[model samples]
Target: MPLYKEIVCNENAKLYLWKITEEIEFFKHAVLLKDVSQKRVDAMKSESHQKGFLAVRMLLQHVGYTDFDLYYDAFGKPHLSDGKCISISHSHTFSAIAISDQPIGLDVEQVKEKVLKIASRFMDVSHLENLSDAEKMKKATVIWGIKESIFKIKNETGISFPKHIFEEEFNLESKKTIAQLQFNAKTENFNVVFDSVEEYIYVCAFEVDPNFLQ
Candidate 1:
């Protein structure tokens, strides 16, 4: 499949998502991977993972970027050669990338009942109260995305989802929320935007700045 979804996040940021429907060989011939990325793809044990990896390159191409324009830091965080902040994520059949002038994080997670089973390990259980079983599962998945997205941006040592990141209570109907990362004796706020995409939750986090949400 081509671009599955695109969101103009702001004047300086955009998000792209791709649905993985092509065969491994199709993508292998469509995308040109660097030597290290080729080795990484070759080392993947699952065909699904390899497809997801290549699908991301397809998204990069959609935005007039090629694999050569991207690079990863020592912490595995992605960067653009032209000095743009970028975040990448993939889950199941979907792959996504977000580019911004400011620091950002993006995460895509398939909504599954399994997330509820381990909710307490990463989130405040009290926030799950007064909700139906279905809502519980959906909300839990969003919270998981919240933590994962924040971690992707910070990418710092000693950041624990359960111990350091906290989500402020918000109704799912709102389709938006706020969170905080309290780590290393510092606290930073983030503005969160999220929505469901065909049984999957897509979450994007932006650091609270003077121009944020303006």
Candidate 2:
């Protein structure tokens, strides 16, 4: 499929998803890549990774953008020539991009038992109590996505997922929650929204603005 899903995170941001069903040639024929991008894609050992990178470029075109408008920072975070914020993620069979006028984060993780296995390393286990096996897996994946999204927004080194990012207790039914990033002697809160697409959980986070709350 071309564009698998599109979610309007808010007035300023939107998430575009592409389900990876096409082969490498399909994406190569569908979009153009900058020379640097092409070289990076050429160096990928896995064809899946190459497809994911091209899928993101396909999404850029869907949003009226092309690879020419995109660039990466020293940290490998993506930036747009137009000054809009962009975050990219891909796992397994899915790839996504989030674009916004304000700083934002995006993550997509397939639900799996592995996340629950190492949940302690990145999150509080108390929040997972009393859920069925399936629920536990999904929730753990969501929390993981929350932390990842926040990290993208901060884009700073030495930030430990377990030590620095914390997700408040939230019901899966609510499909939203609050998270805190405590690092560098500062604490910051983010407004998080998440939803499940197919078997993957996608989350987007926007830094909380106290003035906007007022």
Q: Write the per-residue lDDT of candidate 1 for residues 92-124, one digit (tens) a residue.
A: 999999999999999999999999899999999
In candidate 2, list every pair of residues with a backbone clash: none
Task: List model 2 lDDT by residue over 169-204, tens digit each.
Answer: 998988988899999999999988899998999999
Candidate 2: list runs displaced more than 4 Å.
Answer: 209-214
Let me know the TM-score candidate 1 reaches against the reference structure: 0.96
Which pairs clash inside model 1? Answer: none
Model 2, residue 84: distance off in Å is 0.6
- The TM-score between candidate 2 and the true structure equals 0.96
lDDT score for residue 158 of model 2: 96
